[model samples]
Target: MNAKPRISILFVCLGNICRSPLAEGVFRSVVTEHGRAADFMIGSAGTGAWHVGNPPDPRSIDIARRFGVDISHQRARQVEAADFNRYDLLLGMDRNNVQTLRQRAAGGTLGKIHLFLDYANDRVIDIPDPYYGGEDGFASVYQMIREASEALLSKFD
Candidate 1:
């Protein structure tokens, strides 16, 4: 049997209540489906501390539950300086998140930070924020992450 390389990924957003958690959950689900779940370390965090220690947004949990993905156990937290040394890739939900991460990155962290959609082969688009939108908005964001995560997985194969 061939051993797969384990890659650590950190998904980041503004508050971590919506986008980041959803991206983490969706990306995890995709990797599991591809039988590479064991080959990746996935986590989520926020740029700010507003929602630190809180669970993902209720709306996000509801939307994910509808699609059979569970993000209920995930909690919101701010990205720490130590994360730069821990994760192999730091994925941002949008341009702002990427900028925030870049501003705080130390050492070689800047090179690991990237917009999540940068991996998407066909639809290169940012995952829209669903915090103020409806269920459909969450679903759309999920699809974007799903596609992007698949492309990312391909890169490691």
Candidate 2:
């Protein structure tokens, strides 16, 4: 019997307060629900350093808690250069995030960076940032991330 290799994933966003943290938590929930938590490495990061060392936005925490997942403990960190080669996949929440990752990725690691929603069943799209919006936006983004999270886990599992 052989142990399966873990799939390492890093979810990235602008400030890491809203979208990426939710994505990380959602994916964790999806993997745990499917009993595949031990088969993967999961994390989230921000493209900018403004939110580094800060907890996820309160709205994000509330929305995840509403869905039975707690994201309050996740801290924001800036995406490091080492991250480009550290994870098997670096998923970006939107076009700008993806573009930034691509730009920072070394030539050999380019293929591992992608738009997070590419795993969703529907058309490829960016998960909207909810920082400037109301709670309703957070809820909508949660649903979207959850869908894509489930799809992503299935693809790797």
Top TM-score prediction, candidate number: 2
> How far is 49's C-alpha from truth in model 2 (Å)?
0.6
What are the lDDT figures for the candidates, one per model? Answer: 0.87, 0.91
Q: lDDT tens string, model 2, 113-153?
A: 98999745555789999999999999999999998988888
Candidate 2 global CA lDDT score: 0.91
lDDT of 1 at 61: 90
Q: TM-score for each prediction?
A: 0.91, 0.95
Residues 69-151 of candidate 1: C-alpha lDDT, one tens digit per residue: 99999999999999998999998888899989999999577899988887545444577888898888888887777778788
How far out, in Å, is residue 18 in model 2? 0.5
Candidate 2: RMSD to truth:
1.5
lDDT of 1 at 53: 96
Model 1 segments beyond 4 Å from truth?
1-5, 122-124
Candidate 1, run of 10 with poorest lDDT:
118-127
Clashes of 2: 0
TM-score of candidate 2 relative to the true fold: 0.95
Task: Flag regions of model 2 displaced more than 4 Å.
Answer: 1-5
